[model samples]
Target chain A: MNVLFQILFTISILTNGDIKVPNSGFQPGDKASDFDLKSVDGKNYSLASFKDAKGFIVVFTCNSCPFAVMYEDRIVELSKKYGKKGYQVIAINPNDPEVKPDDSYEKMKVRAKDKGFDFPYLFDDGQKVYPAYGATKTPHVFLLDKNHIVKYIGAIDDNAEDASQVEEKYLENAIAALDKGKEPVPAVTKAIGCSIKVKSK
Target chain B: MKVFTAIISLVFILSASKAQTQVLPEYDTYDSLSAAVFRNNDTTYVINFWATWCAPCVKELPYFEAFNKKYKEQKFKVVLVSLDFKRQIKSHLLPFITKNKIASEVVIMNDKKYDTWLPKVDASWSGSIPATYLVQGDKKLFAEREFANLEELEDFIFSFSKYK
Candidate 1:
């Protein structure tokens, strides 16, 4: 019985039994996995690059998805709002550049520069990193603590279409909670928006 | 003047009628099972997975409701399975169903463990709503994403009905 309890606890920590997200999304209380992927600026970025922060925001977004596009300015806005306070936001493009041509390196640079992105927009070529983070959508998010542990995973806000009617900002709340050393009030929320398009086999 | 008024009224009526045309809804339920419900029917099951938040899904819902109302007497039934969170079942889902007066059976998938059960349907589904599938006997039809109109849906149904 003790063995079963230990296994269940470990499973709960590793994979939320709810099965909402594939085993591929970051869950609360899990250690944020590290990887070196290309930033739109041609440099590589890893969790280590943002070491000076009290917490970090890792957003899985792309150039084409309308939902991601809608949230683009807000993503920059959030970074500007919180970056000065030691919270770093890193945007990762997890879609296969091949499957989604608009998501290619050149286009990523164009969009980032065109949009005046204040944060790094990293490439997820071969699409290996998002699965480690357990992200499912184009605008999927992962919030990490100063220690590189995942504090929250879900949408940036509740309303993607209407900012005026916004009810919740999952990432913002998690960042606030992490900054104060409090457990994020809601560790997980429903991840919405376009599914990340990976390379076809 | 009378003739102009008559023409304007006719145009108004035509556009108004077109506005009410129902669309078949689509959804990304996050999980779909092959539906043991498929076993009970000798007729085709035209299941359109949709959610309330999806605009195209909401627009196409009435057409599906109308299709079910019109053709359920024949070998056809439409099922609107909402992919919205079970928590939304009471708030957004039920109100949407009631508001639309959706006649077909409505089910909110309460299952959150999506990957385990969703793959049980087809591992290939990338979890988009507004997806559809039609099954009749040994024949299978799978649409990975949204449909354009009821004609597209009806074309499949009628074609399959003849083939069956």
Candidate 2:
């Protein structure tokens, strides 16, 4: 029975696309791979593009996701507060336009304009960057230091519904730790958000 | 004239009662929700963590509903744990549930401490919705994505529970 069960489990993993294989993306302490993707402002941005920056707050987000929408203002606030401090916020829409039309580059440009986004809201065309980073959902954040080492990988903060009631700012704290030349305490966190839409195989 | 008025009022009351009959999902803290799913029993439980705001989760909900209905007589249960914001319970969550007539046992997980509760649900979970947990006694399987169809969902449960 145990042998049969093991065989069944293995087959399920093989056949089921929903079954997540462990550790498919970057973890804390792992160096990130840089990518050049197009932003809504008609500019190409790679990690090297921000030469004067200290680190990057690469947030995987999109226009349609309510959770992402909830954090839109906060994301902007993060950029404004930390941009001068040398941390650049590079928001990426990693969802496939075919799967989610609202996440298409055109709609992204609309969202960016409407929200007055002060950061690069880039489209991960062909859906390559997110998989490489192992980002599973929109509003998923990865805070990277100047060396491109992933300092934190999770939510922007604890409260996704209302920012005024936020108790802990995970990404901000992580960035602060990196600024002070120390490791982020609780470097990894998680939050409920929309899964990164991809074309079904 | 009296008879006509009486019938019209009866219809109004009936429709009003029907509207009131829609189930409002109970709000649960993470510990209470966890306790409910981790019950020690012979029945197999498929706990799906989702929300109305999550498109993929909303799309895949019918599969769970169908599977639960199909296996109504068996030792199986489907518990839909909604991660929708507590504030939106009335505005969005309840209305969506009523509009779709989602019959699965739905409850709102009103916990915001993802760093604490997410790992408790599954160490591998990265806090994404449309995730599911199938539990029966000591055996458990966690899938972090949406099921494509009813057959796929059934296969996932059957793999662990051996339920037909």
Candidate 3:
């Protein structure tokens, strides 16, 4: 088995020339690239569009993921609570709808309407934006400072199963810290979630 | 026709009873499960991460079962680690496991903090289900994706087990 793994590893290196998937290099403190994506309201949105905003809560989420569904209320609440403070929540559906029909643009619209989302729910149509942000799962967040620099990257909170049981509100804390003119505490965290569905090769 | 119908029902009942005979799985934390699977370094571990709610994970479960049955003589072991919620264990996961008659040892991974254990399992793992880990002593190969078919799974198993 060791020999087999060694051979596969060596062959992968020899054949592919590189071992890692190229796009996942985004990290905190790095500047986030602005995206021009159509929102559920039929208007196009970009980071530059928010004139008076202090920063953005750019969340890569979808309709199909259980974790995403669980956090939908909190996401909406976050936008409502923080939007007044200049941190707008921009929810992006990064899943390829062809792979997960429930997450299709049409369904995304339905979900947003049903949940009464106050934020812009955009679709990553060609799946270009998420790979750039290094988003691996639904509910994955990238909090950006006013300069478009990433301040936090991770789960909405420490708990996804139950919001009441949540001991740490990561996103809220980050926003509060930013509001207080400080760096976010624990800028990164992990939570189990559905992987962002991509087109099969 | 009536006699034939009776025979069919009898066969169905027998198979259904057989399917229900497998033991129920116990829930384990990530640390405990990891320790259990890696307890014997001499054995090759084919640990598959899956969940009942995941369509892709269910689709590839049969391939893992087939691999386990086919190589029962070898030192190879297939441990199916389910990521299903604990509350749904009795209502969903167990019934699914029984209906499928999975041959591999099944366990529910009860860890909630994905960030802590994901890196420990595999540094490159992006917390995706339907992923697999092939562990043999010091060498470990992790694939954060689903198997296309049994052939692909078998080929992977054979590739690793050949040198042994």
Candidate 4:
């Protein structure tokens, strides 16, 4: 009994010290994990698929949230403007469809088509990718370099309600800074957004 | 004579409708809002950051209402701090509050400086709605997720009570 108790205590200490907490994703300067999620186009995409890309604008968004909907057009515009610059935008829907029916894969396809998205809009099936990246809300972004290093995280800009009234384009500025070989000033930001839906236990 | 009667009825209807209308206080900045609601006093303040558009927030609102109702006589207060857009306050927020007959004190937090104000609420907060902050005389408890039920909310608030 004494030997068994000692072994159990040693295992507990090892587990507690090494394990990463769920949903506490990668922070700045941390190496982000690559995912092979299915896109709305029915094709699988991973960071490795984008061979020529210098960096990626990996935004975790969904179909239903008002804040996500508000930023949809802006996300499209970012892909268009930044694609040529070798910084590709990869959109992912991380909400569990069981919790929010509107975020179903079919609706995501419709949304992607309707928005004329020029980028790969992937679905984080099983609700895996966002938690791995630490996304807490719809429209949260993780700016990663070619080396898969998370350089920035948070909102796309200063404003979520109105794009026209936006004063600072955080994502755009981050890309611009990278182009000039400088670090993003405010490495992380926060914006009021719908909490990422997960099925209730 | 007919016009006089019509005018009197109009005035009575207007006054009666005004009595039914719920007056929602709007705060354009977080500093002013924190000053009013997050008072450093003996009263335990349960400040819930929520919005009308957030489904989880809407789902868990009744629990907050029930909690408020149960604790009204005590040195406790429930303030529903709405993160709804300023433009939608009239069209979306007001109607929802009035229709639900929400008795808890509701106020709009329209400040756009989320990066600055969100950390002030709780350093661990990631700007998600349905977050609850329970406070009394500097003792604070912040929950970044929705309360499952009234008991859960009561348990959260009571957990802070154990401090003092």
Candidate 5:
């Protein structure tokens, strides 16, 4: 009986604990992975570069996704609003430019300038960082604490259309909860947007 | 006399545009969409979630249309659910559907609460486009990825409808 129980426990651990999902790289409570990706401002950025930061508002967004476009101003506002409050928004474009021509590096630069982005708009060249973070869609967000622990992962708010009608601001609430040293109520959420296009194999 | 002629030409243009227009896709919420998919009947439902902006979704649409036509002769129904924004129904979706000559029943799903409805469609769905849900009686299958070709999609449909 003891041997059977041990075998079943081992099997469950292998199947459930370490199950590998393609493109799903992180989960809530997982450590935030570091990346050295290029920014549109002609500079390289990494989480380690921010020495005094309390946390990061990491958003995976693209120029082409309509949902991303809808949330662009809101994302910018969040970055600016939270930057002084200790969280710096680090936006990353994870789409392959080959798949989405509008998401190319030059276009990203133009968009950054046109939108007057207050944060780093990094290009996930080779599309490595986002998959590691398990981001599936454009406008996906990951909030990390100072220790590089993922605190929140999901959408910016409840309402994608008509921001004024938004009753639940998921990202804002998470940031506020973190500010008060409390865990976010809903740590994970399902974000709806264009899928991150991978390089055709 | 000039005003009368102008009115006649305006009416002619309006009627001409109307001739090319097809019926707009009916919009559905999560509950209604789920109800439509899982009808509790023996007929297998092949539900595809797509959008106008998704390249892969648009690419595989023809395959779905062909399958819908082929399966119409059998115990299968294909529902192409459009995730297009409600406002774009007239401007983009209606014209695209007409231009493409899609034969399948297309429905606009403007429900933005993906978090609530995604699991209801399929627990495995990561809220990605080009997803397909198959349901028949008690059996349900969901694919979160796009079909590479018609054969692949057909294989999925055939597998579900074989014993139905």
Candidate 6:
């Protein structure tokens, strides 16, 4: 695996194509906007209901992404650990079913059911929510306070492929900070995962 | 099959035109061109590498298009590279690029050498989509995450251009 990563790094250096995708909407310290996304059971889940929590966690994730799937246990652990502490964890599926059918509503339901997700799996139909939150990658996490203020925005952990070796749990720290009424020091970290599939115009 | 072919044809025409105007000829292998790729040739090169199946890649493409419009006269060029499979050159690459109407230079670097190629682009890149590298006048900055808006994008460009 180290050799593979080294080779990939070399290729990136060697490839004449030296550029990255550009999107500026998702950044640290941005105020999180309220969302009225529909949950799996056809009910709307809004930020208003969780306005009283010490903090809220909005993770722009999906059912099919390996990065997201690996975090399933941790996400559940997060919800279990934080939900009782007044932090709401909501998962949003921003993929276009017309393009990627595996991310369709039904698949989301089955995956959620099969995985025993304890969080709300919401669907952003027109994709009006992710850009507001500036979510560019899957399993992209946004930690907010009770006032819907953004505390942290980035990956859930340091390691996506290997959960065991995670050195820094970014999301967990953000929640902990919010719980303690202090600002999260390292508010943004590198999130290695699949990108959110916005509808191509 | 007729609809599919029509779409494919449309995609090809669009991408080819953009490439003629903006995209440089792609370097397929990851072991080629390390220093020259970022050698400030007086042209501000914007390289956006993404795949068809990547959602974040699709999400941020419009920003590249917008950047092209905002900086066309200042020796600024946006180059979009499709990181799909080589097989997609005919079936998926052309149509996706064409239909997107991406006015920037578009090329399909359909090589599976990501493990060998992703880091060469930038050591910070975690093999993620929507990653970007901005090069201007011997200055280079790579952003592993996504940007939020045009102002931020412009700031990144201006800041890097000022580098010693």
Q: Pick the TM-score winner.
A: 4
lDDT of 3 by residue, B1-164 (tens): 99999999999999999966755556446778777667556678899998887778888898998888887668788899888877887789988877887768988787777777877777677666778888888777777778878899987767766634
Q: Per-residue lDDT of B1-164 in model 1, one digit per residue for the tens?
A: 99999999999999998865543333334333444356655787787777776555676777787778778878776777677654455678767766767789665554444433444444434444566667777665655555456776677667657522
List DockQ for all candidates.
0.11, 0.47, 0.33, 0.38, 0.38, 0.10
- What does candidate 5's lDDT look like per residue over B1-164, in tens digits? 99999999999999999886676546457887676556788888889988887888898999899888877878888889998877788788888988998889888887787777886776556676888888888787877778877898989888767933
Report the CA-based lDDT of candidate 2 relative to the real structure: 0.88
Per-residue lDDT of B162 in model 4: 46
Among incorrect, acceptable, medium and high, the docking class of model 4 is acceptable
Q: Runs in model 4 with CA error above 4 Å? A: A1-23, B1-21, B162-164
Clashing pairs in 5: none
lDDT of 3 by residue, A1-201 (tens): 999999998888768522345337478889999999998888999999997899999999999887788899999898889888889899999998889999888898899999999989999989999988999878789999989999998888877777887888888898889888898988877666777887668
Candidate 2 ranges beyond 4 A from true positions: A1-21, B1-25
TM-score-wise, the better of 3 and 4 is: 4
Output DockQ, candidate 1. Answer: 0.11
True contacts kept of each: 0.04, 0.73, 0.43, 0.65, 0.53, 0.20
User: Per-residue CA lDDT of candidate 6, range A77-157, in tens?
Assistant: 889988888888999998777867888988989988887888789998888888777676678888888777788877787
Better of 5 and 6 by DockQ: 5
Misplaced by over 4 Å in model 6 are: A1-30, B1-137, B141-164
TM-scores for all candidates? 0.62, 0.88, 0.84, 0.89, 0.87, 0.57
Clashes (backbone N, CA, C under 3 Å), per candidate, total 22, 0, 0, 0, 0, 29
Off by over 4 Å in 1: A1-25, B1-164
* Candidate 5 off by > 4 Å: A1-23, B1-28
Q: What is the C-alpha lDDT of each candidate?
A: 0.73, 0.88, 0.83, 0.88, 0.85, 0.72
